[model samples]
Target chain A: MSERRTPDVLPGYEPLGAAVRTDDERWPTASPDGRRRLDGLRCHPSAPVWTHECGDLLTPEDHAALDAWTDGLATDPPAGDDGPPPAVLERLDRLLAVVPFYRRLGVDRWEQLPTISRADLARAVADFVPVDADLSRVVQGTSSGSTGSALVIPWHPLDIARDLPLLEHLLSRCGITWPRDPSRLGLLNVVHQEQAFTYASTMTWRDEQLMSRVNLHPSAWTDLDHRAAFLSEVNPQVVSGSALTLMDYVDLGLPVTPLAFVSGAVDLSPAARSYVESRSGTTVLDLYGLRETGPVAAAYGSREGHHLLPRTIHVEVVDDAGRSLADGSAGEIVVTSLENPYLPLLRYRTGDRGALTGAGRDRRIVGLEGRAAVRFVTGDGRTVQSVELTQRLQQHGVRAWAVRQRADGSVLARCLGGNHPALREAFDRLLQQPVEVEPVSGPVALGPGKPRRFASELGQ
Target chain B: MSDPLTDPLDHSVEGPDLQAMIGRLLAIPPDFLAGDVEAGPLVNDAVRLAGVRPAGDEAVRARGLGELALPERLALQVGAWMVAGPPLAPLLRTAPGEGRSYDGESVASALLSFAGLADAVPVARWTGEDPERHEEVVRALCRVLGLRPRGETHGVAEDRWVAVGSAARRAALRAAAEEQRKAEELARRLAEKRAQEAAAQYTHV
Candidate 1:
């Protein structure tokens, strides 16, 4: 076996064995101008040492398959209201044959199959994976979003690369052209949290353009002021982050501006979207998706609702009984996504509420209410994002929890399983007040519908 | 054991006759005969005795009835014989055309007619919890099997079967509890493995 060499640009970088490209096939180095930009980013007073490593890990065969898949998306007609298209049904049939979870259900009809929740995935994720899937190339990612459950999803590099085409399609729909600029960064993924996995990598699909995931928290940098300076120096073509992160970005008073902003992970309110767009002088595309289902829909600038993005996915609104409701009816949003070859989601309940309006290409999810963007104010008058609390609680190994901040600035927290006193101490330190941490039996005690992970009585 | 047909003390057989007695016994639900008995393995056992294997391996199918108590064993045997229908012919010790006095195929045919009637049995005396009620069903099965009751009188036989049935039911309950404990232990181990795999990666969203 040939030994792999670490590049000088990515400090403390470790390459994964699952990467399909050999050391010789990797990009030799960044361009001369790109190297200068990288130096400025690395030399920033507050830049954190890159801690984790990842790559596209796509092979030549995967590239060819992605091209064909994207081309098919462009040529295929919009899905009608009748039922699942033949292609989706065919995939479902194959899924039942290979996936143990679906085979045990023994249901041929798509509607008859029971809806699966995040808790189900948390319990036994291997059951959903196909028996014939290639485990050698699989990479794992955990999602402990606003939902109290932590699910580890096994992802294929090819599946993740497909997100590029979907984003390109969304960008094209808005008449935005993303030209390749070797000098400037291609994309900047921002996260405003106490701790996160920060990395810089070259986007092979975007012509080896530079991309990085940077945390905006003070601890991630040498100084707080460097956040704006580092962002200005990168000058990415497009920036992507959650609604809360973008709000933080706007509040930072940064001088740099990108062509567009992609807000996801949680719902983006109209007021927040308008503020981000006006402040940055760019359009804010509110994306609706979960880590489990890639990119599902996007709402353009000032649009009332989100339009469906992928042709392969079948989105629906279903009642509590797992029966599909009428188009205009409001219910939990369920999706049958064919994106991940390793995990074929059949009627996977997303635990978000929405209404499906119109059909085909004009289909839009109106009145979509996903994870609430909750911000808690500490006793010291400092504002704390719920994501920070999520990081702390997860670090304590709290599996499932819901936290609510009362109007009095006092907090009440409940968790399903974890070290209770440790969790209480963690909360008290974050909120800067004596917080009550109650131990609960199950997810239902948290609340009805979706477990409201974080709720605030301190109104927006 | 003496043949009930020749036994002078087997007066109960003369009153109801063999077919009527078998019909009555077949009419009782397996649960009514013995509390909390699983019929799946009993049916599988009967099928296996008739020379056909079920879906799973023989060891797995037999594990359900393995080491069962006396009342449970007797209940399963009677239940399996009742469910055997026409398949019980080949399982009979006497082969057809062997110059045997009794025609095994005719007896098997008689049992087949009463096969599915187990589900239609009424709750006349079988209270499911009372061993004395279960004893009545066992006495009827003894006559059908051509064996005399062990006791001198009907009341004596009923008393003995009740004591045995009661002990078996208690053992069955204990076994069920132990099986449940084992299942819970397995689930706990599976949950630990899942938690380990989830934390193995640094990727979080």
Candidate 2:
């Protein structure tokens, strides 16, 4: 596959590098090679897919509403100041005062906490929560609970509001200026869950009419034609999902073009990165977030990595012994969300392993291996890495099904409908072990909760 | 499976006393409830609602029991047996022999089963009455069965099935929407109150 690598690769893009003056200016600073890649990946007009109402993608009203919501926190651009701003400090003070758990963790400011891990937070949930706080308000949002211990979190409206500006700011860095009307624009979301995908379309939060959801579940799309048709129809300005899912489009000669392509939830392979940029002709921005904390870090000017949203969260990369790792050191990522007071999550350890890169004064997190526990294991006892499996499955025609491993070592693969023999043969050859393939005879089963992509016999 | 005198489940199949029937039902495998945590209440409710009684060789229950049929004679009642009552039974219920297609009975059984398995899920008390929503309910139920509603059986039943399916979905959606609306309202009110307090402080100057 490297043989196919294009000769024209962009030079390193460091958001905090010499080329970028201030962190906020990174969005406007496009790398020459990044621009070229963005130009090359435009979708050819051979396919016609449904266009969601333009109002669904963006709305002026929504922007106005968002701006109004953040008016209280909006501060004048630094006035040449750098450390934590006064407004940010004030917000931090309030968060510390209101969220007793955060106060107990001693995380009063954005820089106070270290990177967090899932295990650390689960322990906190047991101890930190005010004995009287109704546990249900802060619901647990987990991408993978391979271990019975999943991150149980509390939801807070203030937290979501604070996180949005940072997300929008990061998005702007990658050329996705949130149009006043989301419905007027096109969208293709490549994410893991059904709620986020559907919410992008159905829900009227902020009134940004995100009317369409061309949900490309990274592991579900397999046919090149389907992929092409989907991109052609949506013509999204922003193409976002796990890095691997977008690369599959590039791999299959499907259009990889978007004004900005954002990847989250897994480590983006270097080869996959090059393929995506070369094909889509777009700058791929990195998004750092976990199920517990929605959107924490986003890439700005440099393709180098993501910058922390110092307003909504305090980011840290901590070593295993609960000590903070120096910049450029790899360890578990822990996050103390300054926003979510409903169920304040302090020093929440995201299972994903990552490290900060670059030296002092120019530090940012560049290396990340998103959650790997959410992967499927084949009968051969080999792990079908989630990111890789998604690419392979999306390349084929399978969509929307559950894969469960029975206690007896048999695998049950369910599909809404797809070409079975080919899928079976692909899995057989891929797994290198013969396994029984059973076609689901009815509608794929959905329990009361969010369905998982892969499950082991022991239960997740 | 022959009609044995006095079912093996009890010494005499004759009208199972309330305690005896409840005990037999409890003995049924937990998996029969699909490992649902709420299965206890659902089974209890359905049994209570059906008011199963011993009469002759079969349980002397109301014939035309709504729209479904009872097990007549069985050691333990399955999910399918829960729907063997009025209106819901006839449109969607499925007897063991009624070909794999979903009848109202299966849908009812599934709803009852899910109600037992999950917590506070609105399976029994749906809010609306739309055929489209009923169809969605059936589709949702089928997902639980691990079956794709396709072939001739897909969307085969008529108006009643659609109405019932729609009503179920409408109820669920309405409840979800209501919950979301309430949360949003509370958030807004809190923000508003804070803003007003801030304003009041400024005015105090």
Candidate 3:
């Protein structure tokens, strides 16, 4: 390939180099010899190919309302006051009317009924799959199995259709304006194996978007060389992955920086999010959702609440009795998959808890109050979020910790890696109840693979 | 069988042949591309646009690229590769089944980045002058530029692709050290801030 190297290529460029620095910078590539023939190498930035063309799926008013909702703006004359508007409820009704599982239940209606749990779904899993669709074409996916059991849900293309535009809307929050010409879009997942899939398996998905998905597990590549080569080659404008995977790169000190970073699955703490954002020089948008549900909520920025995708699904924050809680009160999160007829889930309990803010199309989950076990009941029966308890301990430099609410309502705890030499007085005063604190020697017993900030005698 | 005339990757001969090659590469006759019949022109554009202006120690110095010592030029070159390489390489390296193309603005940005890196690499070397520090610099440069300096491609050729693997084994170690340094400082600050907030909240409670 180097047989006939252009001799004096250096000398020739010297004048051009001088012109670049000292005067009217003549970009040498402007010359005919340097003319770039980039037709195949580059795409013309035309209309987006990634679009589902589903914007019209919404009634014009609903479409405009959705646009406004995603843009973080209020629609004119607001879609609804306290309850959802007619269009929103109709969408949910239409989606549920076709649910294979609902029809099989031999029930006239499922909404406002006892919420479905993972155990219930697993027991009747077959009923959820749409009766009309061919089994071959449907895509089956498994959940994270974090809450004791995993739900394997089968989805048709229509199930995933709302996701593309909804994601397009969420990603926009990170200041990532897409339809980027000459850009490679890359996704990373850390599956704890060496390499589950080869690097850069699929290429560009559109004329404007070149896509690559890579597993960033230690076993995936031979070494850093392979990791660097593959990732830098697929240099993405926006790098989206789990919080753990993003932290792995940050801790490894990999130098590649993307225009934006998006993380989902696990909760990203402010401290960890700060480290990654500072290290990568980009903002991290925490997209909160479940495997059964696609893109249910997202925090546009680190400190913001998880905003609900009101157009795609209807969300209800219900108390223990299945009664809907008003805005500002935390309760179990129940969601209905508004678009999936193949395997529809209505008022499914997510095991997570948060409060809703705003009304109708403007609704958002201000913040997740952690899982049910994270609740700390005060002596006067006041429920305090475990994150608040940890935040107090954290201020005192408590690095690693696990706080458990005993059956008697007292608190037993493990604290490690901080300046909490005396914890009982500090904690008891905080909880307004007697507290037992023991500094854990090794890693704290936070429970399961992923730890809960707070544990309880009662389960979620 | 492709004719040598249409082999757009060829840079073997110069003068009118080079001009003809460039013309062939740049000129994709509209009718010829009626039904994706411009594979030659397509490959030509990719090769031409992605081609770097490789330089050597002297040429690099002239352009104020290699004028700075060892790792500085290497560092500059690496930053450029991060820019140019990501956009161009993925299209060629990982062409999807659907064969999606990238837009020109992204292509131009990528090419310019490669150009920056290409110009910087002429004198991108370690002179064994300060073996300990020079070794560290070389390895850091390799990681920075996303180049795995191998035994096969490591030299200071004028206007040619070069990847000097001066002490490649220790490159990862050096990069790791730098990375740890950045993380350690931030981790410390985050922990302290968390502790403060926790303490205050507890007191209020």
Candidate 4:
């Protein structure tokens, strides 16, 4: 198939190359309405020069399956017992038959099977993929998790599109409706990072509602003022980002107010949530999930905890020994999800701490402690968020690290497995302080269990 | 180190001939099979007979040999014994007790089957790469020879053999898991590269 040409409406369109166009041809099934929505986003004066090309790439069959799956989600039965439900067990059996990793273990019972950790995925992801899964449609996204190294997650387009309905369900529960409005952007995914994959796409599932992922970092825009101008003009109905990014949005002081703001990736304190809600005149919902596991639960308006979102996921709190902890006991958050066909995770350990309250459809994750947004004070008394440190550490290819700042503002970072001399220099430059780098042999040296990646004693 | 007595092991058809051959092969006195031997001497003998140097005291202490179950400890000893020795094919053909005769190639196969590792590992790997399952192999060897180590009752011997066999099966599964991990790591790298290339074209939120 010939590559789809960029429409002339996007005068700032700058293609990365023709290579991107080979498999990323415009969605053949895109409705005319969807095409117009895409053009509107591209033609907006506030839009950055298009750096790359992409679309929903959802086929007619994928659309049908996604719709059925989304529609059934509301009525789907809640998880059963401490063990996996019958359906999940059946899927596990199928996985054992085809997935090499699970087959090699020869574990038939759920209790006997070992829990999978992020390290396992980072080391050998293909082992978990079923042999029969179609690789033709696989797309990848990198997730720089709060605790570990960046992981490249393989995603099916249908799985990516599934987030639309999941979001809609969350919104509807909060009494918010996202009607098709061409004048306003459907959704805006904001990220405050040194660099990010920024692009524009129409949500084909949501009647081609316009959506885009924009980096809030100043480097992403031609003028620093464009950040506010773009947000003001699009006035996105739903804004999604990490709690840190949402705080940046509030700091931006843009005139645009969305119906709701979705905060993820980091823990959102009540004060911070209230701050964003009051500043933007919008409700802030805390979404708890990892890149490996899609949206698991969301804390909506006045909700005591994060209400479970997907019916296909079974959440459990497991102790260090991987035994299931009773409800109300805080432990590592483990999930068994059938969300992605390409990667069916069984008893996947998320490394986040939370307690499961209630049972069945009423299950909620309480006292959820994800990656805390830690701010490090530099030598000059300047404050820096852990996200920036994460970016720097990831750039150095250092995995499994812990960065701690003493009360005197001295930074000490212990990294596992590799000797990184330049990492200290990188840290020194990032924090504007002389940082000490210690190379350790294993994860244990970083500390017990999952280490807290960032900590500051400066009382920031 | 071929002795005339060991040479005719392949032709031996009687249980007594096989018993004599086993004594010569293991370099133990014929009556020693019926006597109790201390574990230290047995371990040293096995290490010496296998033509491999015994591990240092520190290494042995680190492995906690004294803390391990008798079968597990024996497995380690037997593993070191067989790791470097000549093929057991000739002696195995003359093994008694079950009224079974194994061909040269099938001796290792038979041992592997007895240990529940027939499908999980090849004879070459069991002999080489895997020292962890060596005791299980020795237990299977004893079952074929119908020789219970001296000082142990039949019931005790039988129970230890069962325990070692179970350990071997678990080790075999772990070996398979390791193999899959390596293969999957390679596959994951390739898949990751392809995904990166595809993602370079276009990515989602």
Q: TM-score of the candidate numbered 2?
A: 0.42
lDDT score of model 2?
Answer: 0.41
Please give the DockQ score of every candidate, comma-separated: 0.04, 0.01, 0.01, 0.08
Top model number, lDDT? 4
Docking class of 4: incorrect
Lowest summed lDDT window (length 10), candidate 4 chain A? A4-13
- Cα deviation at A133, candidate 1, in Å, is 1.2
Cα lDDT of model 1 by residue, B1-205, tens digit? 5423123234332122334434545565545344234444554555455443332435433444433322333344454564344322243333322242223233332222222112112122232454454544544344444333432355554344345444544443343344344334433433442222221111112
Worst 10 contiguous positions by lDDT, candidate 2 chain B: B196-205
Candidate 3 — which residues are off by over 4 angstroms?
Answer: A1-81, A84-88, A91-101, A104-112, A134-136, A186-205, A369-460, B1-205
The root-mean-square deviation over C-alpha atoms between each candidate and the true structure, in angstroms, is 15.3, 20.3, 30.7, 11.4
lDDT score, candidate 3: 0.44
TM-score-based ranking: 4, 1, 3, 2
Q: What share of the true interface contacts does candidate 1 keep?
A: 0.01
The B-chain TM-score of model 2 reads 0.27
TM-score of each: 0.66, 0.42, 0.44, 0.72
- The sequence of per-residue lDDT tens digits that candidate 1 reaches over residues A30-105 is 3455445544554556566554444555566776887888887777777655567676887877886556555433
Evaluate residue A164 in candidate 2 and report its C-alpha lDDT on the 0 to 100 scale: 43
Q: State which candidate, 2 or 3, has the greater TM-score.
A: 3
lDDT of 2 by residue, A1-460 (tens): 1122111111111111212122112112234543333223223243222221111111335345556646543343321113334544555565543332332233345654433344334443433333333433232233333222233344443333333454455666455675544323334555432112121232123232222334343222345356566555445656566765566545555543556676766555666677788886777766667656666666556457666654445556776655777767888776655444454455666655667665322346676664322444555454444433333343354544456656664556665456667666665554444445455543435332222255557331
